[model samples]
Target: MVQYTPRWVGKQEESIHIAHIASVKIDTNLLLSNVLIETTGGANPIRCHGHHKADAVRMKALIERYQNDYYRGGGAPVGSAESTPAGR
Candidate 1:
């Protein structure tokens, strides 16, 4: 599971389990790099910014690895496809 604390005023932290995460997207530009974590729990993806591009990439990889491990361990919902991709 990944625990993320959003940089928002008066906002509480949130926890995202590996089995529930749908995707991890990394967006980078000349100035900043951000990671968007999409989950099956909601419509809004978790946005994490202010990290180096390499760090964001590493985070994405780690999340995908956990997700893959979850599915391989038979944690995916019944009747769902077993060979689903790690990220969308």
Candidate 2:
């Protein structure tokens, strides 16, 4: 199951975030680490020598890592379009 938060933006209701946790396989022998992992979206399946079930703590850490990368990684600037004018 995934965890999500809801917030109110003006008069509209919105979801703040959605966090998901699942078991992932890591094949050290694989040339591409990402291929060794699996996600929900439509992606190419990869070989899995073994899998490790992630616990709550590990899931939390992974969520944090994902958030950090999405928000602060070496890519487009965060809040690029969310900023609002002082009077608006």
RMSD of each: 8.3, 14.3
Which structure among the candidates has the greatest TM-score? 1
lDDT of 2 by residue, 1-88 (tens): 2323334653433222322222344443333232133345535433333323333335445645665655664432244343334323
lDDT of 1 by residue, 1-88 (tens): 5454646575566776677788889999797799998989778988887889989999988777666766776676333465356421
- Per-candidate Cα lDDT values, in order, are 0.75, 0.38
RMSD of 1: 8.3
TM-score of 1: 0.69
Candidate 1 off by > 4 Å: 4-11, 75-88
lDDT: worst 10-residue window of model 2? 13-22
Q: At residue 82, what lDDT does model 1 achieve?
A: 58
